[model samples]
Target chain A: MYNILEFTRNRSTSVEQTDDKTLRSYCHLNDTIMEAYVEIAVTIPDLEIISVQGDVLRPHKKEFKESFEFLKRVIGTRIGPGILKIVNGLTEGIRHKQFAFMLEECCHAVILLFTKEDLLSSPRPDDEEESIIYHRQMVLDNIRLYNRCAAFAPGSRIVEGIIPKDKDI
Target chain B: MLKFMRNKIVGIEVKDSNTVLAHGFLDDNIYSIEMNVLIDINHLEIRDIDGRWNRWTTTECKRAIPFLKEAIGLRMEGDFSQTVRKVIGRRACRHFANLLLECCYTAKQASEVLKDKFKEKHDVNNVTSENNSDKNVTPIISADMPDHSDTPFHDKPVSFSMVIDLHMHSFPASPCSSVSVDQLIKEAKRIGLDAICLTDHNYVWDRDTVEDLRQKHGFLILRGNEITTDQGDMLVFGMEKDIKGIISLAELRKEVLESRGIIIAAHPFRGFLTVGIQQIGLTLERAIKRPMFKYVDAIETLNGSVTENENRFTEKVAERLGLPKTGGSDAHEVSRVGVYATGFIDKIKDEKDLVDAIKEGRCLPTVFRKHAGLR
Candidate 1:
């Protein structure tokens, strides 16, 4: 139930706490999925993932939805049946990607982490990496926007009051 | 008894001896057979093979198979004992040794629980547990080509270097598979290697050897370890500590990613035993079904010293999958040090960057030595 969502971390990951609304506005610029994920992540005990929310994220990321559905289809399959197809697909994709990395001379990927605690009402297995990545990306853009907005509204207690404790850092 | 030739004029027979219980075929004549004494069934096994001990067994014969095989072996060994020295060649010795080893391994395995299998043989245990258990990847010795080129051999070998063999007990540590770390490094330097991973089975290269060598050679030595999982070997970079027999491949992946390291599939295409590659007997036919390109990262293009067919089979799989492939020496010997290397096209000036480049797939696998190609 505990999480420290990342913002594409660097050496300077904040050791201090900051305002909530400001965080939302910051993550929204990256994508709706992250925004939605972060919005639900904090209230782990209360939030329930409904079809309505799923539909919202589905529209936001068609690729993720397609990948997720295909993954779901493989749940009950015996290891031998779909393993070849899944493995071949993965390796072939990687092969093409490797060639591209050499030719392009660079490589990039966007990864996200989502915890089952936020998605499930009952206890379930959680992937901390997925949750952290999801929240990190979720916070990235919104943090950028919030920083800008806070710069102008310097007097707002919501932004200015979360003191950056030197000791905590 | 089955008859070979019919109507023999042996004075002992009252009737035609060939016409008995079951039927038989001959030169324009058919006959039956029933009574049995001893069978010389060399013909029926595959039909007319000259000198084979092959025979078809009924249910009755099945029960006695184990004892029959042992009896035959003991009889042969005893008969050859008196002057076996003159006739014994490599084959006889090998047969004798393999039998002994099988018996020893079987007895040990039966007495102990499977969990206790890795004890005593610390080096092998470390390698086996750390390199192969609970991992989702099998090392495949295969060659991969880019879409731009269907063939890997069209161009000359690419040149670059990255960490390899970290999981092995380094040269100064335990000498198992091939060469010492020192010899490996020397050979790599001879070829003007930009870097040598210097990793071994499961343990880290002793810190002093690396520190001394790094200061002297001025080449990049990346941190690496080859992990053993249930599926196969995973050549992992930028981590230390034994991850062997501790977690499943699924679990390993989570840790590997979180640690910000790269995990490459080791020799995915070469089949023996590591992953669930079935024993090659009645099960060989089922192999053609698994398209072979299923899971994991960069295939091992050149394993420092396997046969050409092993390498070629791997190459075909990489082509079929269009996967970003890599090569490693899989070297345990010093001479094989730089035999297989990876070329990272990135600005990876050192170990960390090298990992980033490989994880990103900005590399080419190459086999510098012409030791093997396709045989």
Candidate 2:
């Protein structure tokens, strides 16, 4: 027997400090052969997007000329609350929704980069039990991290007793 | 690589003429749950809810079992799923919330089916008296029942005489902000804010525009800058210089000192708690040693954008440091204008008065949105 359908998607995000005051975040998404990428430069502390650049390498449709230009609308947006709304509002008219997702991913990567050190600073747990307890408390303190990763997936040990806030009805 | 799968099953049965039983089972690689809810079909209200965690990962998972009772009186109506999530999911586990929501949905569907069956039976029996069929039939479910989800949880309005949102941004100045000055002012007035301060990132509202907005709207408008420094963000008041780009905390402190302005740490612990302080070993003692605390005059303990834990951590640091705490919405949009504000004990007539109030510690944090329940 042969499989009827097979599909795979690969997405990557990287953040690098380009200058003393700015950090550049780059995101790429590739579904089969079609690909898209977004690069955003944001100022530190404020995390305001000062510049944006991206392209849809293999357009799903012929109207690829202006598909990536819509990302410019998020140039001044800060990586904070309501960012998803801002990005969605900007790309509402765009044909390729993946571009918007990629842009949002870049912004989130920037945020993760700033806090990477804090995460790294955590003491390494000695055993599986200690690791589970540490991760559980981590998600408890930051509910937003719930179900965001494999370790925090529902039914996982880390999120066993945690109740979801249910931001969306 | 490892493959994992989760299976969830929900079933609804008509237990009696007026009661419906909805049960759900969830089984996965690491956890298993079984739950049953008895609902009154007449009112679509949950009468009883019982659940058991068959296979669980942690002991805390059992804590959610008690919260399941909170759904007993909840009517499966408008915003029913949301209410269930808030009451059960938020307190113990989201999985339980999901299961209860699934049960509620299934029960509602089953009730509708029962109602339809009853209506059909009534129609068959009243074939001779077609008009009388509606006379004796009572509606099992009310149509378009109003839900109190929109009602404010708290009725007490903010009693403060002078409430000012000290941190706000406007478009064109703070490029990141979507709300323009006009929209910000309109929203501030609409929400009954006594005054609003525009603290755009590294940009200050010009005096001319501030005066024009004040005169046009008949509302007090002040200007400040949310200066980005090497250490962290600072809300600087009484400074008129348009210090572009990021500046060092020491430079900002020097400038504020020269100008005799007051600086409030803006969400100082914004991302700290999210990183899991215990794992990182960032204790209160280590947090207080941050360089930004040494320079700021006050702390923003209540910020709209920060999580409650982050705000509490900031409050703790402020208490330990004996620094006065303030509040701000950090609003980039109009609707978020007065979510949090600073209440002045003394009337603040101008920027100077506002600066003096902060310097004198005559202000405290106030929550304007009653639903936040932070007051």
Candidate 3:
């Protein structure tokens, strides 16, 4: 059985170390070890990083409604801005899979975001279960590896599609 | 489900093998953007010392709506049985489009490209199961811009490629190994193979041979080399004409960079080639020591020559390192060229364009053949 675990990180600076993280699954479904990190693949001229603070937290908030809004800006503007964001407000509950910080205890959980789009986009897909190979890989990372949304994970948002819920998928 | 959604106006994002792809919606749907398939041609322009993003030269990418429609239309007919066969058909469509672009280069170059394609596919009327399908021979032609080039694939073009090995030789290849260059060329021409790199083991002989073919065919023949090191084997594109001198992996890396070549760790964990991609060579400690994997451009995630597990492991390592992923057919025979080929979305006029695009990290590699990327 392939374990799908979705996670998120706020920003690069916030990420202390990715090598420290590993995906050790319990089902013995092939030890799929996962590692997460960020990268700066492009140079955005005068690119500004809008901090999500104060009144800047709406859907289209100057800062962003939810923190995931930052990813939308990157759609056509820049391709991969592997930015790192700190995961704060751990108390905030998201709608997708259950999300928490510790990797030792949680399995099959996700770094649930406030949006349905986020929920639809974060789970790892079994081979052939998803249409787009790329979208499947992203979901696979979240399932077997790491984050976005509250944290500035490079894979914070995007890649929305239907996913089979069965483990056999 | 994809075919079900007609005109959904789907969006695509292209990225390098190492660059992590991010999306703002559907947290559950985020996917890894393979570097081999990410070619942004619409806004691509080779930058010079003037720091100006000038067009390549004498070309224009007319909205290829009619041809694109026919290609899709044929696929929509729904009688094709083989995935590989259908892929071949799709490849032809792409070749047709590429030939149209070739018209912008030079008359000689354009003719070479068309002739190469025509010659290869000249007599093979039974490629597909139904002989009638071959009757729909569409000849594509156009005029070149000559004084200038058309706009590229994207505003900030990204490129991705798959290594389609159709008639290549390896170090271990026996004397009777496959040398079906004609077959490979035919497939390339039909599939609209953007660039062909003949990295046959340590020598660049294939490069020269392909070059002649390219000059006659109009396809980009990248000077290629497969460096065999104690660490393992590596495949690179865009190099000097002769790959005779013995160069260490480090030196090879430098040389490839100097010549504007892109290096990819082929089949990282499979066979001896593993010694090349993984910093640690044969040990599991490969990625552990480097901690940064700075020497590699991308990882071979899909090697058509090997098993799915090999591809999976390659992808797993790439994902682990956060490096982008790539694929290749690894075919020494021509019939299997595009099996593991790449699709770069750049308005390239020649070899230099591909090398430049790859070096700039404008590439993506993917397994989903139907996934339409950014327009």
On TM-score, the candidate that comes out on top is: 2
RMSD after Cα superposition, model 2: 15.4
Query: Sorted by DockQ, highest first, which candidate order results?
Result: 2, 3, 1
Best by DockQ: 2
Task: Write model 3 residue lDDT over B64-127, tens digit each, in one string.
Answer: 1222333221221222212212232232222222222211111222223334443344345323
Poorest 10 consecutive residues by lDDT, candidate 3 chain B: B1-10
lDDT of 3 at A72: 23
Q: Per-prediction DockQ, in order?
A: 0.01, 0.05, 0.02
Scoring model 1 with DockQ, what do you get? Answer: 0.01
Model 2 misplaced regions, further than 4 Å:
A1-169, B1-159, B371-375
| Candidates by lDDT, descending order | 2, 1, 3
- What is the per-residue lDDT of model 1 for residues A1-169, given as tens digits with 9 covering 90 to 100? 1122111100000011123211110111122112111111111111111111112222365543443232222221112111333322322323222121111110000000011112222111144345434333322312211122211122322223322211011
lDDT tens digits by residue: candidate 1, B1-375: 111111110001101111101111111011111111111111101011011112211111112222112212121122222212112112122112222222222222222322232243334534321111222211111111001111344265544444333222354443344456666666666666567775555555555666788787776566677665434456777665566332335656777677776676665433232111221121223322332224345566555434344455566666555666677766554444555666666555555776776656777676543323311
In every candidate, what fraction of the native interface contacts is reproduced?
A: 0.00, 0.03, 0.00
